[model samples]
Target: MRITLERSNLLKSLNHVHRVVERRNTIPILSNVLLRAEGASLAMKATDLDLEITEATPAMVEQAGATTVPAHLLYEIVRKLPDGAEVLLATTPDGATMTVASGRSKFSLQCLSEADFPDLTAGNFTHSFKLKASALKMLIDRTQFAISTEETRYYLNGIFLHTIESAGALKLRAVATDGHRLARADVEAPSGSEGMPGIIIPRKTVGELQKLVDNPELIVTVEVSDAKIRLTIGEIVMTSKLIDGTFPDYQRVIPQANDKEMRVDCQSFAQAVDRVSTISSERGRAVKLALNEGHLTLTVNNPDSGSATEEVAVGYDNDPMEIGFNAKYLLDITAQLSGDDAIFLLADAGSPTLVRDTAGDDALYVLMPMRV
Candidate 1:
């Protein structure tokens, strides 16, 4: 195989494909990326058995053929090439080595048989839809932070994606939780998204999907089945196996009757939490919230360290109350709020507290209070 392409184009395609290639591989073929140069395009594919990504870029194909080479090594070579330099790749007659050249520099890499690359099985999708890039980005950004890192509860290690009826309107929702905190967000379900099975998209897939939707101008075509998910954006196709675990009913955890309500500037509250938490070094990093009419005080106490307290003006008219929560959890939820004020609906000192953005109802967060 022989192809010529601009350095920048080849580097971008490599960066996209190499995310799935594991640095240390037990299998030899998995460490290499399959390169197919045919017609006017070069297709680069990489996989780690569970996740796979393919990116195609237009290139000047002199001799059309296919080969596999070290994914990261090739990427590094292309990245270090001078700007605007043209890269040339050619396979030796024996088909065991690939020669890469640009400017006055050249290198040879061992090539593996392309026929040995594993194919990702993406069966007939039960549901298909087209969604705006921005909408998909919002759905992921609002919930992914709360995904559980614990492997024992594998279901909670991913974002739960499903379609639900909200106020008689069909909405696509993403929910994630780790037992201590939860995040839920919804958007109008795209056409043809009906009857889609709820699926748990694993944490790695969510991170890789974010790269494909970073461009807001593109519309992503999503196909989902009980076992797999496929996302196509332009010349890039990403496929991953869904986690085969049951997600707990997150709806039951959200409180609907919390009466004590408080509204505070989101930025002010986040800053106060950050400042006060500096004093505590506990695993939970618990911070106590003291609330009264028109005022809120955030305090942190650590016997080994020190104590800190910060007062932030708020719009609280409820009875005096004190609630304790993990400082990092509070920061994560508040970072999702883009508006000026964040509304908190409290039940008491022991029950979970509900939080939302004052500007919109599309997203909600629940934090299980800790005992101070």
Candidate 2:
């Protein structure tokens, strides 16, 4: 195969697909990206068994053929070439190696037969929908931080996506939890998204999808079945296998009757927590919040080090109370808030606390308290 394409165009497509390839692989083909030169374009594909991404770019093809080359190596070579340079890719007649030439630099990469590359056969999709990129990004950004990293509980390793009737409207929701904290966000359900099966999207796929939805104006096409999901954005297509486990009932964990409420400036409260938590050495150290009529005090104490305290004014009318929470968890939840003020609903010192955004983002948070 012999093809010539603009370096910038090739590099952009490579950047999108090459991230699916893992550095270490038991099968050699799994470490490489497949390149197919056809009529007027070159197709680039990479996969890691669980996830696959493909993209096509216009190229001048002298010969139509296909081959596989190391994904990272090819990406690095094209990245260092001169901007706007023309790149030439040619494979030997014996199909053993491929030569890459750009400007005055040239390199050869070992090739694998295209036949050896595994294809993630995406079966027929049961449901299809179109959603604005901005809405999709909001769902991921609000819940991704709560996804559990524990491998033993595979069900909590991704976000739970489904449609439900809420407030007299059909809404699509994303929920994620790690036992200590939970995040839930909702958006209006699209016309074709009703009665869709709930799917658990793995963490790696969620991260990649978040990167591709930066263009807010674009309408993303999403296709889903019981076992897989496919997303198409412009010339790029991403297919991923869903987790085969059942997600727990996250709605049961959401607090519903917390009557005491306190409203504080989100920025000031987060800054105070950060300042006081600096005295502790552990990441999950508990920070105590002491609430009064119109003021709040944050305190952190570490026996090995010292103690720190910061005060902030809040709008509270309930009786005085104290609650403890993980300092890191507090920061993670605060970072996701899109409002100037944060509202906290508390039932007791031992029960879970509910948090809401003043910006009316249709997102809610549940945080378990820690013993001080």
Give the runs in model 1 whose Cα sits over 4 Å from its true position: none
lDDT of 2 by residue, 17-111 (tens): 99989999999999999999999999999999999999999999999999999999999999999999999999999999999998899999999
- The TM-score obtained by model 1 is 0.99
Cα lDDT for residue 57, candidate 1 = 93
How many clashing residue pairs, candidate 2?
0
lDDT of 1 at 151: 94
Report the number of backbone clashes for model 1: 0
